[model samples]
Target chain A: MEKSSVLTVLSALAHDTRLDVFRLLVRAGPEGMTAGSLAATLDIRSNTLSNNLVILSAAGLVRSAREGRAIRYFARMEQMRDLLGFLMEDCCGGQPELCQPVLDQITCPC
Target chain B: MEKSSVLTVLSALAHDTRLDVFRLLVRAGPEGMTAGSLAATLDIRSNTLSNNLVILSAAGLVRSAREGRAIRYFARMEQMRDLLGFLMEDCCGGQPELCQPVLDQITCPC
Candidate 1:
């Protein structure tokens, strides 16, 4: 990913509310959650949730699909992967072992 | 890492200049770079670099040590690891395969 893209994703997630929303959506998985449910679960105003979702969508961190009268939002896992890859691109200066701990932490055991 | 620390790190890196400086310091490794050299290399003003470094240090993304008359700064790899871990904590929710691609990319094969 380019620097600007990384910057956008970082900025989108830098906020407390957005980060919580993203994590909630990540846990919700591809099935996603309706914006109304998300707003209720997060205890955020509809307008505030709408604004955060817009920022996240613009950053390619989230995607929305219209289902019935509701809009369901899914966390874009690929984008998160790309951002992580960009951050670790030059890590350890070609010495992968130096980053083993990081690898261990991010590698899901389940 | 806590949400606040992650926010601080993200906010610190959201900027173009600070991101460049962080990536540069990451590539520079533990040997680090002097403030003067970092300023010249990035073509940034001393005060600007100083301010950025202070922000980075406060966010625990960078560490500085007095070397002679210069303060050499190194990227705090552990903190980066923690931040990445925090972001990926709920990824795939018990389905590692869903996040395998993310793992492969960040694994750092040398």
Candidate 2:
């Protein structure tokens, strides 16, 4: 990811509620959760959750897919990978070993 | 890596200049670089760089040490590791393999 894209993603995660929501979604994995369910779980109002989700979606951290009457939100692993890569890009001053441990973590199942 | 600490660190990184400076510091590693040198390299005024450094220091992302007349700044690797761990905590829902790649990267040589 470019610097701008990284900034966008980080900004989306800068807030308390949004960060909580995003972390939960990351745990939820690709299957995601319904908007209403997320709201209920977070103890947040639907409107507030919708607004937070919009911000996250805009930042490419989370995506929403309409499933009948409910909209499910899932963390975009690719975008997240891009984010981790951006921050780690050029890490260790050209010595990949310095960053090998972090790479060992944060993998995509697919 | 608590929520509030994460917010503080992320807020410090939210701005363009601060982000650039922090990234540079991270690249510089434990030895770090002098304040004046960093300002010169970034083409940012010393005062502006100083202010940004204060924010970063306050957020615990970087630490400053006096070397003669100038203070050299180093990325707080422990704090960074904490930040990463906080974000990745509970990742993959007990399946650590899911985060192995990222862990493979971002390690300390020590």
Candidate 3:
């Protein structure tokens, strides 16, 4: 990912509501969740949720698809992975041991 | 990391100059880089770099240490890993296949 694009994605995630929404969608997995469901679960107004979704979409972190009458938002796993990778490329100064905690946290199921 | 702290860190990295600074420090590893050097390399004013450094320090993404007459900044690797892990958990719907690109990009020495 380009630096500016990655910055945009990170910026979109630097908000409480938006972060929560992204986390929720990540947990929901590739199947995703409908906008109405996200709004209900997050207890955020539809207008506000819509705005957040727009930002996420613009950042390419999430993609919304029309499924029936609802728009389902799924985490754009590839873009997200790219963003994460970009930030962590040189993590722990090439000593993997120093980054054990991070690796464990991400890899551990529990 | 708490959600808020992660948000703060992400927010700090959302900017062009700050992100470049952080990435530079990360590439510099534990040795870190001096404020003046960072400013010169990035072609940003010292005052502006100082402000960005302050934000990065506040977000716990960077730490400043007094080295001789100058303070050097290093990437807080643990916090960075935490931030990356937090965003990447449940990535690719647990298939792991989908996140291969991200992993390769980060782990590849190229």
Report per-candidate DockQ. Answer: 0.44, 0.55, 0.36
Q: List the residue pairs that clash in candidate 3.
A: none
**Per-residue accuracy of model 3 over B1-110 as CA lDDT, tens digit each:** 67888889889999999899998988888688899899999999999999999999999989999999999998876677667656765554565566544443333121
| Model 1 per-residue lDDT tens digits across residues B1-110 | 88999999999999999999999888887678899999999999999999999999999999999989999998887787678777876676556566655544443322
Candidate 3 residue-wise lDDT, A1-110, digit = tens: 78989988988999999999998888788688999999999999999999999999999988889999999998876777567657766555665455444333333121
Residue B110 in candidate 1 has what lDDT?
24
Residues A29-84, model 2: lDDT tens digits: 76788999999998999999889899999899888889999999888777877676
> Best to worst by lDDT, what's the order?
1, 2, 3
**Candidate 3 or 2, higher lDDT:** 2
Strongest candidate by TM-score: 2
Ranking by DockQ: 2, 1, 3
Per-candidate TM equals: 0.87, 0.88, 0.82
Q: Over the stretch A19-101, how does candidate 1's per-residue lDDT look in tens digits?
A: 99999988887688999999999898999999999999999999999999999998887788678777876676556466655
